[model samples]
Target: MATQAPVKTISPEEYLAQEELATERHEYIKGEVRLMSGGTPKHNDLSGNLFVAFKLALKKQPYKVYHVDQRLWIPSQQIFTYPDVMVASKPLVMQEGRKDTILNACLVAEVLSPSTKNYDRSEKFQYYRSISGFQEYLLIEQEQIFVEHYVKVEAKKWSLTEYTEIEDVIKLESIDCEIALADVYEDIEQ
Candidate 1:
């Protein structure tokens, strides 16, 4: 029988350093690094639409919006992830000397794709909840006009609201930003 090599577990610092030099992005969870898969065209459109909506709504405000390129650090769970869309109202918290990784995000949004839908709804979201400042989570669907909004009601407690119609408006109580389903699914053919 042939013996296989053991998988290596790397520290967050090492993962970050290596990630900076790599061409693709990855998510670091509990010392394990996994490459992020690509999103579909409809996924991109939904994510882009939401990002634009938040950008315009939070204009001239203290909130800063970031897309998938930005890394989010969840200290409690030792996780490093890239949310589809993130909004930080308070002063951004960086990882050590780097400005690309933020520790605090008021709202995090994920556009659900078939490949990552399960992880996004379960494990990934479980990690995101560890962030002290995380207040809202939006799970947007690519195939239909559906959105599952989870708002942090109190410590460790979250409330979920679902919207299924294009005319529905998602009220993001955390940042006081409202997202219209029509706008989010605009130009999306899937």
Candidate 2:
């Protein structure tokens, strides 16, 4: 029988130093870092649509909507991630000495990819819950018109609402925004 070498974990500092120069982005958890996977066209479209929807709805509010380019830092979990769509309160708490990463995200949305749907639904969701004001989560399927919405109803508790039809609408209580399934699936094939 052959034995394989154990996986090595790098410190968060080392990961950030390398990320500064790398072309592709990476996610950091505790002391481990992993390169993030690329998204499909459908994934990109959904992310952009959701961002625009939230941005327009909260234009005059004290909230900011971030697209894929923004990084989120969960201090309690020691995790750094790039949410597909993040709606954070104004005066975003930035990681000390860093401007691109924010410390608070009231709502995080991810467009489900076949390779990452499971992680996004489980571990990733768990990480998001650790943030102080993190309250809503949206997992959107790229292969179908299905969405799983999780709302934080109480401390350590959450309620789920799923949407399947294109006419369905999600009223995000966390951020006080409404998004239609049709708008999210607009121009998206399959």
Candidate 3:
């Protein structure tokens, strides 16, 4: 008979503190820790293009654009996530002697990969919707032409719109900015 290895269970706070100290990135899901995978060329290109567009449009504005390195802490769920692109309208929450929590984000974009597609569309989307300041969420596909835009409608409702073609313009009503599909997929060998 073969012996099975023992399992380890950790609390969200422990997971977060450990992840913070490590050099690599990880996602916390209901106290479970999952290692994040690397993005492909297409994913990197799309994220870069979107970041550039947001930077240009929000230049000198009150909002600040944060790229992949920045981590967002979701207090309700006790999770830390690194969005591909995030825009914060106000200063984030900071402890007296600790780092700040990205609590003022208005818009967050996640470029979908094969491994994270379902999780991003479901679990992560649900978590993001719980945030009070989150107004817009964009999920861009890596292999195909798919972009799902979800805008907060009322207090607890969200309106979703999908764009599939290169000619379509993704309208971000929260930020008052519009981006063409071609610009998002710019130099990638589609």
Candidate 4:
């Protein structure tokens, strides 16, 4: 016979306290605190490349480009998560007491790793759509030259665009930025 303790959910307040002092990043969903695992080098490279591309493109603009560390708060879902890359032109709206958590995003991107690819394409995409200013979602594969781009066309409707060729240029509607897949996968292995 075996006995297991019931799982417990912590308040977002408690999670925030621990997150501030903890070395690792965590996602707060509803009332649960889930630790975020580290990504592979390939994943890191793609994220870095994407961030660099956005930074260079919006250098003089008023937009803010964020990499993995900046957290996003989805009020509708009561969740806190970090996107691989995010570009925002809307006015900055910080989570009530946090400078690192933002409430606005025009584009949110995720570097898809094997373990998270399915989730990122489904549940995570749904969560991202809840952002007030969110319009475009980018899902980039770390193991291949594939990107699934989604642009919101209407309420509850989004148009899908897929790119598989290295020469493909991803036009981000919300941010009015274009990035090449070759640049994103630069120096990274398949």
Reference-based lDDT, each prediction: 0.90, 0.91, 0.84, 0.89
TM-score list, all predictions = 0.95, 0.96, 0.88, 0.95
* Residue-by-residue lDDT tens digits, candidate 3, 11-114: 86687579769888887766667788988878888999999989988888778898888778777877778899999885665423457457667899999998
Against the true structure, candidate 3 reaches a TM-score of 0.88
Please provide, for model 4 over 1-190, each residue's C-alpha lDDT reduced to its tens digit, 9 standing for 90 to 100: 8989866788778887888898999898888888887998889999999999999988888799999999888989989898999987747888897877898888989998777889899988989998878899999987789999999999999999999999999998877779999899999887
Selected candidate, larger lDDT, 1 vs 2: 2
lDDT of 4 at 75: 87
Model 1 lDDT per residue over 87-167, tens place: 986688888888788988989999998889999999989988888888999999888888999999999889999999889
- What's the TM for model 4? 0.95
Worst 10 residues of 3 by lDDT: 92-101
RMSD of candidates 1 onward, in order: 1.6, 1.0, 2.5, 1.5
Global local distance difference test of model 2: 0.91
Model 4 CA lDDT for position 54: 93
Which lDDT tens digits does candidate 2 get at residues 126-171? Answer: 9999998999999999989999999999999999999999999999
Rank the models by lDDT, top first. 2, 1, 4, 3
Q: Give the least accurate 10-residue stretch of model 1, judged by summed lDDT.
A: 88-97
